[model samples]
Each structure stands twice: as C-alpha cells, then as structure tokens.
Target chain A: MAKKSIKIRAKVKEDIVTVKALMTHPMETGARKDKSGELIPAHFIQEVVCESGGKTILTADWSGGVSKNPYLSFKFKGASKGDMVKLSWADNKGKSDSVEAKIG
Target chain B: MNLKRRIVLKGTAAASAIGVAGLLAPRAVLAAWPEAAFTAKTVPEALEALTGNSAASESGDIKIKAPDIAENGAVVPVTVTTSIEGIQSISVIAANNPVPLVASYNMGEGALGFVSTRIKMGKSGDVVAVVKAGDKLYSASKGVKVTIGGCGG
Candidate 1:
C-alpha cells in the first residue's frame, strides 16, 4: 500500500516556527482478520520522530491503540522562516516514512 | 452433459456466496479493527509503551463528547476538546481493546484544541481522551455500550 500523505500547517509565532501535522493511516491494530478467519498480525506506527533543521524536537512511541489517521500538533522552538521540519514514523511491519515541510 | 452443467452452476453459487461474505465482514469490523487493542489488564503494562508513565489526570477542561450507546460498533464518532491554552495534543484510548490508543492529535500553535473522528470500538468499554499541553497532561472519558460487535455479528 502507498504511504499516506501528511497535511502540515506551518507558520511563525514570536519568531519561532510552529507546525501542525496530520497523517492519513488506517493504523490497523493487527488483531482484525481477513475473511479467511486468520488473525492479521498487528501493524501500526510504533515510533514517530519530528526534527527541525537537523535537531530533534520530539520523538513519540505510539501503541497500536491509536485510532486511524492520527493527527499531531506540536511546536519547535528557534525555528525561523525557510527552515525545514521533518516528520517520520516506523510501523510495526518495519515500513518507514520521511516527509518534510519548509517553515513559512 | 447434465452433470457438467450442474457442477458449473454449483461452483458459481459457491463463489458468489463467498464474495458476499467477504464484503460484509470487512464493513463490520473495519470500523472496530482491533479487539485485543484494549483489555490491557494492568495500567503499568498498558502505559509502558507509547508515552511512558501516561498516568493521566482528569480535569473539567478536557471534555470528551461521544454517544452513550453505540447502535453499531463499526463506526463511533468521538470528539475531544480542551479549555486550556498552549495546547499540544489529544489521544483516545480504548481500555478494553488489545491495542488501546485510538487516536492521537498534536495541536500546534493557532490550531483549535478540538478534533472529531470516527473509530471502530471492538466492544463496550471505557473510552479515554488524554491531552498534553506543555508538560501537563489532562484527560476525560465516558462509558460506551457496544450493541453489535464491529468485527461481525
């Protein structure tokens, strides 16, 4: 399956860049099975790391309990215009995503 | 000649039956995808992963709006809002599912500290909303009674 695209809202506040990000993911808990009656192994994003200009701002380790298509709102201090912020996560299946946004 | 045609007809019928069953099954549990997500028996074990020491505290500022009784376990609408400022994020956890985190939202600066989304509840259980602003975490919850199991009837 294709990776879900992330929607980010970035702007400057008090000379510090802030970002709000929302991702589109089913985040299946791996307990739901197919029609065949076999248990589907759990598949969910376990860890999410946010970075700004190569500096780690926040790192989150999420459980399979998160609802589908999770959204995250966070801020990074010292970010200025033209700076870039990155969002990424590692799924239980070992699939990873790296997405970026330019500070506005 | 008659046996061959009869066999073919039987095959067709069986295939169609299987197809219909496949469609209905997903539509049901697709809403509540995880049954084992909750039912975490212990708090420490449950909070061990995903935001360690969750040990959430309840407050009036964190308001969770959801239906008291869900007619269909497949799709339940849940909304979490907060009165506090400098909001950071909101997460929903179903205590009975095998994996408990339902939804997590990070509310950046200028964004509303409110979100509404649909989740599949495996069964009737405690639905919790946890909000983190700065270093403080606040939360709220409600009991939802699941009428029909979302995975299948």
Candidate 2:
C-alpha cells in the first residue's frame, strides 16, 4: 500500500519522545449523508500502533466517534534522538497503512 | 462516477486479499477487535465485552482531565493519567454516545499509564476513564458539556 494517509513527527526532549500524528481520514460516522443525501458508510480507523526503537510503545483502538481527520499526541520514555519511530493504522473495513519517522 | 466504481471494486479485492493474509499471521493477544464491545450501546455492556467483567472500582489514582464545557462537540480534548502500577490497558468511555466505548489503549511493558487524545461527543455526558492494572480495573470520570455535533446520537 502507499501508506499516504498518515503524517507523523517525533521529537526527543529531556529523554522523552513526544510523537504527534495527523491522520487524513473522512471518519465517516455512517450516519452522515452525501450530496445526494445517501448514507455514508462507517469508515474509520479502529486501531493505531506506535513503535519506538523496535518496541511497541502505544496502541489505540478508536471508534467512529472520533472526529474527522483525527489528531493524536503522546509521549514515551527510553527513546533518544536518531532513533526510529513507526506508526500504523487499521480501519474498520480492513484497510491499513503505516509510516515511519526518525526522532529528531 | 465511473472512477468511483472502479475504486470501490479495487478496494474490495484488496480487502479480501488482506483477510486471507491476516488468517495466516500468528495470533496475538487483543489483536482482534471485540465487536460486541464496540457495538454495545450501554456502558456496562460495553465494559463487559472488553474486560470480561462489568464492575470497576472507583479510584482516585486515575485522573481525567477535560474541560468543564466543550465548545465544540466535534472535537473534545481528553487526557488520562494514573499513578497505579502494572497498568496494562486504558479505555475511554463516553457514557452518552451511541457507542459508549470511544477509545481503548494497550500499554506496553514499562510504559507510562498516560494518554491524551481528542474524541467526538454527540451530546453532554460523563467521560469515564478506565485503567486495567494487574487484573483489576480502576476508573475515574468527569462531566463534559457539549456545545454541538459531537459523536453519537
């Protein structure tokens, strides 16, 4: 897959790595309508995983209740500058994507 | 549009391929989604599905930070932090949402029991934070009034 849905950044400060991510998703609630007033199916990311330096640090399971184009921020310890951080997401429809970043 | 149909068809094919691949992968704990939990309309039912039990002891150690009044229903900031040890997982429940289980987190070994994120609120209600520590669940909650257009009905 292209993995073009996520934009992530990680920064290390005082031995803590703060990871910020912006996900591009419609987050359709399956309750909304289109231009023609057709119901939009529920298509939202249900799970997100963050790995720092080869160990899973954070994982999130979200429902369609999250807002459109979700934004998330979290911090973790034991990571330093020049380390690797990877993030991946899986949606309700079985679609998945991932992106990697370097701690700056 | 013609392009839209093609995209949907391609997506279906890709989804089936992934379904087959996922079956071959080794099973991991909590890797599969708990459908019953997410679909449960009530708080107790949802918790029961997620944790295998419905009762949670109220604890002061779990701190939930949220605005007293949320100006926008579409985006409400919520933060959860705990002083307890051996924390395994954390879940956020919006009591009034169509689906009470808004979000859940799995903490890794030695990971801090802290999480912050934004969630949608369909209406004003209590936002509960539950932490699973050492086979027991502890929870804290705060009421947040929504202005409009949150998450559920």
DockQ, per model, reads 0.09, 0.27
Q: State the local distance difference test value for candidate 1.
A: 0.61
lDDT score, candidate 2, position B73:
85
lDDT score for residue A39 of model 1: 45
Per residue, candidate 1 scores C-alpha lDDT tens digits across B26-89 of: 3242332222223233343444443455677788888778899988766677777677787666
lDDT of 1 at A27: 73
How far is A32's C-alpha from truth in model 2 (Å)?
2.5
lDDT of 2 by residue, B1-153 (tens): 366854554344334323433442322333666656777778889899999988899999999999999999888989898989888899999898767788888887446777887888877899999999988989999999987756432
lDDT tens digits by residue: candidate 1, A1-104: 47556777778778656567777766755545569865455555656667776666665545544556666655556778888888887665556677888888
- The interface RMSD for candidate 2 is 7.3
Isolated chain B TM-score per model: 0.67, 0.78
Candidate 1, residue A30: how far the Cα is off, in Å: 1.9
TM-score, cand. 1: 0.57
Clashes of each: 24, 3
Q: Poorest 10 consecutive residues of model 2 chain A by lDDT?
A: A31-40
Which portions of model 2 show Cα errors greater than 4 Å? A1-3, A35-37, B1-31
Q: Model 1, residue B32: displacement in angstroms?
A: 27
